[model samples]
Target: MIVSNVSFGCTKANSAWCVSSKDGHLEAAANRSLSPTGHLIVAVCLGFIGTLGFSNNLLVLALFCRFKVLRSPINLLLVNISVSDLLVCVVGTPFSFAASTQGRWLIGKTGCVWYGFINSCLGTVSLISLAVLSYERYCTMMGTTEADATNYKKIAMGILLSWGYSLLWTLPPLFGWSSYGPEGPGTTCSVNWYAKDANNISYIVCLFIFCLVIPFLVICYCYGKLLYAVKQVSGVNTGMGRTREQRVLLMVVTMVICFLLCWLPYGIVALLATFGKPGLITPEASIIPSLLAKTSTVVNPIIYIFMNKQFYRCFQTFVRCPNPSFTSSFRSTSKTTKPGQKSRKVETNNISIAVASMGRPSTFIQNRTNSNGEQGLSVKGSKPVVSLVAHYNG
Candidate 1:
């Protein structure tokens, strides 16, 4: 049914506005409504999902800020991810939700640009951070604990570069390489795929490849190598089951899988929209991909913090009223590696403790001490070894 506004014609199909004449004011009437039933349902659902994401990311920020131990090099990358996702929750979700309900772009052109830029930046940040996290973990699996701990400078550089990279792709829209305007359901803003021309189409293709495809490939390569190393380590020490290490690895693997599942469909849909024939997907149908993409922000906290036993314990301790034991528990301790023990160094100190809590071998430099009090950097049994052997530099 057509909805009558004082100055314009509105349709339920796309919530599009068309005036009877060009001189008619572009401003939609403040009291005008469109597709009330459909918009209301979409609005409620987006609001709920956005709230869950915002709250989860908020908790992550609070936990990282509250705990001193979490300030380690690897966790700083996590903090970066949380900050990016939190900004998206604060700036992008609400605007998109409201616009979805209103059935059109209510925030005007300037708001649309800001919304698209910020959301695009945060999305890129989230993607790059995940890849960096995976690479860092992979390095930890292959490097000494001391080497991993000392690479704080490198980690910081990586975080900064990620933000820069995000801007590199997102800012071009403002420069005429492409443009940002209303997208799916006309309630959200993204790269204007509708502007299908040589320049805009090229930008879209490059953005997708650089932002999504490359990062995905890097993450897969890192995880694959890390898992292979884990398998080799397991086979070498059949007498001692690395139950704890295996469990931690399992959780880490699950997190990467979740990240892919949450985002891959959205990326696929976006690519299809950009490269495929016109009218390939209805605006209403686009909501599914948008919702799936937002879900990544919510699931991140569960993977990065809540599922981690150490972070949970630290959070519990932080929440308690000040006490002598609580203060003591918060204090950092330095442990020297003893001669002749097997240790697996994790990329981050938090990962070390997380694995320790899981009753597995930790990311410590494990050296074997022989009967004559001589220490040898070697695997205990005759099982085949892998690149992890090169990490024993002590």
Candidate 2:
């Protein structure tokens, strides 16, 4: 009969060899009892969905960077978000997938530490970045004059500070101050919450509150204000501009909804894992929650591409830039007109020029023709010419 050998912390029976035995027994039981098919399905589904999101985000960043016209302070934050999400998918999710499937740490101790550190760091940084984005959107939507160049600089600085915050939380695990490693047979690497050290518990709690909860609160607050401002603006405008304002509001609402759906489960799981009784949440159940946490990285790209027309247009332009045939097709479509056109139409293009002078001066020009075909100039800065009729007899 299989016996439960798990114990909390280092008891008298706990030693390197004993720990190895416990691990081996767990591995044997997992291998004998667990079906590979289910694990494979879960891994594939998570990986595919996560990769799709990451790829979309990367496409956004690539398109934005490729076109100079698309560059803006907001786009800069988006580029950072895309880069973070890409790293999460390319580095974090794969490690997670392997760990979840194998039910053990195939990698060594160092690999475990590095994986845990990077996973936490990237997750925290992504959350903080999202909060910053919401605030930036809030400023833009509210039409705050204070949201100028200096404020943009502050946003950039805030992004940098997020990285620092992430590093602060992740570095402790590397130094042996906190226990972070494989939690169970199927769990390849994570913080060892089962260890139940007071210091570890405190550290985890602090990290959770500051990194996750605080950032989420900030995001909600900023987006809330943004929605209110949008509503106020919508009440005043009843034309195309009102429609545009409503669209922006819808996009922000969608982002917040997606963020909540994707991250809430993970946050609950993290909290449970930190404080709840052991065995209350199994590793298998935690996999989905963890997958949901990672889903945010991929979701951002989808949101931007589908919600923003300008981004979509820029993406299309960037993708089609390599194909000469596509350009020819576009040109052909643009130049085509109706056949059998009758009369030539006169087209006048009115040009408005804004001239900046040291003292601020303005002038207007007008041309007029009298009944005798005499032209007159308006005093400001107008000039006219008279056409003379000549008759030649040969």
Candidate 3:
């Protein structure tokens, strides 16, 4: 309408109307707000993505609640992650989607602050939860069995600390350590990256360091340790163990890649906007990374949980309702034979790994009969072999 007025109607319209139309045109261009079509596009994408994340994460929560056997400690951290993602879908995405369709923020200033705060707070919780999850996996693989029986206690503490650490950084912005406002095309809210004042800069720096940097570092270190442990275990000269080692390495790489893919670009753009000269990062460029960050809510559970064979089995069972028929049993299944020792296998589950009072023994032989009473054992002369099975049936 403004463009048409300037292009044709301005010549014949009243002088006042002509001037007002021109001002509106320039203002819209200067604000760099998305056009109506662009906003509708964002709304559609958010609607689909947000609904998927909401449903999947809600299902994950329900699975934990309905099934007592899946309520293991490590699984609790996963549940916490799903909870944070669910909150993001519920609280953060809906508001953004609504504002996008409206072509501007619908809520007032205080609402923007709360919007930014809740999203950032929950995002930080997810990040911290992933880090905590990685560190816990590292400790478990490193066989830190001293406190194995108290796994639940540690996980409960981890859940508390994740939220507490997230709040430690996010809450400061609400109380003037920094500030929250509309960000990324004026349809979403987050930290005021445009502000270059000392207060805002300091807070952004601290947030970058604590919320993003620290969690990433923790993840890398923990997964790196896991790789090293796998390398050591792979020395027993079995193709199965070597293959498992490679799979774990791939999982670690994928995990790290996902972490970077989701968060790193967002952090980079935030920094550039915060410290760069005016217009160094445009609204168009910044919104892509913002969308990627939002996408983590959907990507996380699919990558971290559903992809796991055991979890998928449980998920299938859970959804099947009346006659859930997946017979799931996880075996730690570490097979090893020392120099001259007979071949041995250690079969345990996540539960055994969690509650085993002693460290894992390298080579132990235990004859076992299957549920059908069929006996099987590795013969004495079998070549030295080792295998480590990592699954989640706790």
Top model number, TM-score? 3
Candidates' C-alpha lDDT: 0.64, 0.56, 0.68
Q: Sorted on lDDT, highest at the top, how do the candidates line up?
A: 3, 1, 2
Lowest summed-lDDT stretch of 10 residues in model 3? 1-10
Candidate 3 lDDT by residue in tens digits, 80-152 = 9999999999989999898888776667556777988999999999999999988777666555533232247
Q: Could you tell which candidate, 2 or 3, scores higher by lDDT?
A: 3
> lDDT value for candidate 1?
0.64
Candidate 1: regions farther than 4 A off: 1-35, 144-151, 238-242, 245-249, 319-394
- C-alpha displacement of 106 in model 2, angstroms? 1.7
Candidate 1 local lDDT, residue 163: 95
lDDT at position 24, candidate 3: 21
- What TM-score does candidate 3 get on C-alpha atoms? 0.77
